[model samples]
Target chain A: MMTLSSLPAVSQAQAPGLPGRAGLGLKHEHFIEVLETSPDIGFFEVHAENYMVAGGPFHHYLGLIREQYPLSLHGVGLSIGGEGRLDRAHLARLSTLIERYQPHSFSEHLAWSSHGPVFLNDLLPLAYDSATLQRVCEHIDQVQSTLKRPMLLENPSTYLQFQRSTLDETDFISEIIRRTGCGLLLDVNNVYVSCINHQRDPQSYLDALPLHAVSEIHLAGFAEDTDSLGDRLLIDDHGAPIDNAVWQLYEKVLAQVGPVPTLIERDNQLPAFSVLLAEAQQAERYLAQVSP
Target chain B: MSLQDDFAAALLAPEQACPDGLFSINGADPASRFAVYRNNVHSSLINALAAAYPVTLQLVGEAFFRAMASLYVQAHPPTSPVMSEYGGALAEFIQGFEPAQSVPYLADIARLERLRVRAYHAADCQALDQQAVLLALQGQADLGTLRLQLQPSLATLNSPYAVVAVWAVHQTEGGLATLNPWHPQGALVLRQGLEVKVFAIDPGSVAFINSLAHGNALGTAVEHALEASTEFDLHQCLTLLISHNTLTHLHLEQKVSP
Candidate 1:
């Protein structure tokens, strides 16, 4: 029964926070290339669950790569918005990973992915109400306390809204941050996708969030589809290049947040490492324009 | 049911109506929008399965695999958040699955792939050096009473089908055309220097390794191997294990001197 308290304290000094430059999501295909070339990207982000295995090439490469660059661990399966109590075993595994890698930042979605023993792989949406808000805040608190560090909660790119919802998504996110004292990951692509899907202004949606608390930003691509009424529905597929509109939204975010650590996220249809590097460099150009 | 309870249920069951209280702003049907979540859940899980059992995917082709995997996902969603650990029951599911029965060896292939996945992520342990192993062998102790500890990543599979040959052919371009996949086979799967390698072994070696894995003494394991196959060669098995760096430690069981 290895509990968080039972685990030995991390003896090494904590790694520095993510630099205010562009980073790319670390992929398996690029592990050897990254080690061989040692690109000048700001940091490498990995889905925490991908490296949650006991031992393997994922750990081997991550250990070597972590020595060179700061790391950001993004979790896709924490179920932060689930109605049930948080999963202790999953939290313990996360604690172990954080101690082993000493990632500069840790983040999970504001959506839930598991229900009871069943873990749905996608980040599912939640109803934005007081009850949902309270549960999300408690989950965030539990995660933060268990990991002994603040975690960023990324806003989800949801397809539909709940009719029972009584609060705006931004208000709900703001309330959670206010209560749990957690930072915002500020996924600009999600804001654009969600706002467009719901027929809301993306800029106003961004303005509603607590931008001062944003520690990182994620920029990714989306797939467009139409709903029953022929309204444009944007899906955050992360399979294509970052959309021009999304990149424009990112520029707006950079102007406001002033060079927060940003990531060019491509989970599917991953191109060559050089292609992703080019996207990160594009973000670097935007980051450079932001005043200190 | 609660929102999540209903939501999770509907996500897996397309026949079920969309969960209540979900709406689209432009007065569009919620079911269509809800379909996105359902699609994401199924496709992402199917993709995870495809990634895990790539040879299984290639053998059955994408359409059939996705159809079969969708049923498996609905029946048994992952219990753990770790995606790599998901689909452990797929082999068992494929055994009972009627459509996959056309490919009689698919289940065994699934089993081998699962072992490879497990071996890839199993805990790391340093292999005993050649010098240490040689010293243990030459020590003035009865080799019969000595037990061998194997690496955590080591695993053995005795199958009724030529799983190793089938799996090996899929790794390359076109060896499957002239190969026989019906003969019984044994496989040894272990990670060597971060790469997981699968080797075809004799029935004797499979029994020997399984016995050792079950904590039997060297003498007892040899007996088991000989019982499984008359052609069991102790020296050959020892050489293979040693060369592959499978043995991690050797322990001697002390006997009272009479």
Candidate 2:
């Protein structure tokens, strides 16, 4: 297995970006509350696809809340890991959104969501072979050049792996960062979920990656089920509170990397704004402890 | 086929076998693991449809809606990544769907709900203010040649069933029993500021608004409405449009002043 240490070290220095604190995924249900209260948060993140519409309440509220909070545009449909070329039209829409908001940070996933013209809407896994690695790097390079900004690539939670894979997941991510010069979003919930499902050590998975390249972090909840063998299966459903085990792994990450910008994402079965804010505050407390 | 080709095919087609080379670290069945992706894709897409068509979901129960939406997802997966833009073909799909025939008006309700979704996200444009509308009406000579530009969010639906009444009843409590779903009705959907409002209008008014939306001049649109119904009231329709801030621009066509 090729280790990250064997590869030539790229500069880990990052340009000034999102503050080293915690943020929450801005939900439409909480737009009015956010505007009225103007909560003290590190920033607010939103799904780029949700705001792709030309104009509407989504844009209207986002424009208002953006004035007060630093915004991160997280994209879910870029298909950065697909075998085919990137979707030009979707890329154009993303460009338009970036131009409009000028968000502090932009991120997409390592998983593929679309095949050809049909979008599956779920973040599907990839075989970490040389061919898949090259395709993913090319796609990331295209996105960076088109948007004229370095994007953060997120790690995905997978239920299955392919026998054809030639590289470890961490090694593939390390090479992609080395090749394309993009930063890592470092979704901690995904780390916990994938590690548990695959029977790997979460700490070892984190240590193998180029931690210096991490620019942001995501913490979310997962739904638990069992596989055909009745072993534990973790689904990255983002429908509940962050698991205690994931939080422990996150603290370990902060201890190593010293507080990257973190986001609390709750996409399904959303609770009140106060509940999400409280979770963000909990992350902030951990971040405060690790602050230099 | 390529890896993604095989994977995507199986994701949408539940009957197909899981793609080759997939394995779980715990030695679990690949097919069961793959079922997670299948369930996510189908349920999420179905949920998007259900979100866009709440009334349609209510008219039919959840189980029926999910089953119908699952078939719709397999038949017509989203072309665009924007989930908001997904399920535009659903109204047309429901029309030919064999099971949906029991609720014959289900397709029209779907159509209205889709229009509301579109209106909610349409481009924002400043509507012609009341003063501008008044000034344009004052120019009697230009009235015949006046062309009214509707808001991008404005849409019309003419249904053989009382789609507007049925939809309106769903907004409140206990009114569904009072609605006569068999009566033909027309609807006008427009965004008043941020809120998308749907109003029940007469069929002739639908014809008039549709004509105006097609860029027909005032005189021509009135004639179209009159042809649709002898009792078509131009004043009432004009009031509805102006009050709802539907007209964005009033243009007077320039011809040789003969």
Candidate 3:
């Protein structure tokens, strides 16, 4: 057997150009397809926790892809909204992964997914109050200190609204970014979905957003459903094609926000890679016009 | 003020549930709205568990797995936000679960599956060579007390059922033959490159590796192996371990005569 230690250290140096382009989430079924063809997309993103293990097919494919393209480590389990101290072991695992992969960007959700020892496994909303805002700011501070890098916190697609919310969603996000010096992962699809679900206007909400802090953009599909009391609701399913309305919103967002590093996310009901490539091509066309 | 804390409290206290009175014009009821969040949480977690314990889920069909997973979640909703690390205590839970008691091997299967998951996520390290290991072992005059360091991803599990056969069949994507539970089997779990691999180990190798893992030196571990089986082959066992990357580190200390 070849001596692995004798070989030169794997050049984990980041690829020069990754930012300001459209990317896609690399899934299992697409790994072989991606490896063979090497799609012309900007970059790829993976859930850090998904690859948090020692050896698995995930790492194998990721390692292969890492050599070719820039990657971002998007975390869904950090639970930045929790009240207690951050989970050190979880942070350590993430640190080790970062040390190995050296991703271009690392991010997590602004919403909480865990409370005490009970993790809901869903990005549940938090009431926009001073206490909760302060808690979230402190958690972001800890995460930045631990990782020694600024992380973009994505806004969640909320289903329910709280009556006692003293602060607006954009304001809360702005406050967190201002206090912690972290960046924002503006999910335009989420903005449209949450605005409809909460019965708010998307443009006004966008107007209030801290556009300068925005580092990345996420565009995904949304699902509309009715509640028990006969009300219309929009859910961020990310399971279908990007709705035409959302695409139009993305156009509006691009016109204002300039060309951010946008991602086309599809978690369920994955289609052919070409189908995704086609969507990305359309995004590229839109980005092409505005980038200059 | 903590939305997560308040929402979590409401989810737990389902009996006293009061709708938040928030409604959209398209007939999306508040109760229905709440249910969507609840379903997403439960289904995602259940699916995550199923992914981690494929063998356990296979033994008990999806229906049973979902039911058991529901109970497991309520009993121990994940402490960490990482769902991959959620089912750490599933083996113990299976041992005591009344409905699954008939299977008997289910708990062991859970143990093996959990080990596989752990081995996958374990920290990456270089395995030591045979020459280095031998030199380290030779330093110890008394082998009984010398504790050998097991690979961080290594795990040993024994089962009354044909766990290796069961796990093997389930891992394959094609049609699989049904497994019989009568024959006893022992398995050693470890990661090779980017995949966690499982292999069957003889009774002697199992005892010897277990002893070495508990910090016994080669001489004493060999004695334990011989006690388990007179025809024990320590050389072959050590070679197997070195080849498989199960023996990552070695430590030698003074042995105590019993």
Task: Kindly indicate the candidate among 2 and 3 with the higher TM-score.
Answer: 2
- Write candidate 2's Cα lDDT for B88-193 as tens digits: 9999999999999999999999999999999999999999898779876986676878999999999999999999999988888786666789989999998889
TM-score on alpha carbons, each prediction: 0.96, 0.97, 0.85
lDDT of 2 at A181: 94
TM-score of chain A of each: 0.94, 0.95, 0.92
lDDT of each: 0.90, 0.91, 0.78
Clashing pairs in 1: none
List chain B TM-scores, each candidate.
Answer: 0.97, 0.97, 0.82
Tens-digit lDDT string for candidate 3 (A1-292)? 1121221212111122246778998887799899999998888988887777656667778899999987888998888887667778888989988888888888899787777877777887777889889989988888878887778889888877776678889999988887887877889899998888878899999899877666678899877776675566777888889999889888998787666677889887789999888888888877776775
lDDT of 2 by residue, A1-292 (tens): 1222322324332344677888999989999999999999999999999999978799999999989988899999989988878999999999999999989889999999988889999999999999999989999889999998888999989999999999999999999999999989999999999999899999999999998888889999999999999999999999999999999999999888777789999999999999999999999999888775
Q: Clash number for every model?
A: 0, 0, 23
Which residue pairs of candidate 2 clash?
none
The C-alpha stretches of model 3 lying farther than 4 A from their native spots are: A1-18, A28-36, A54-64, A88-100, A178-180, A270-274, B1-3, B12-29, B128-150, B172-179, B249-258
i-RMSD of model 2 (Å, 1 decimal): 0.6
- Provide all candidates' interface root-mean-square deviations: 0.7, 0.6, 2.9
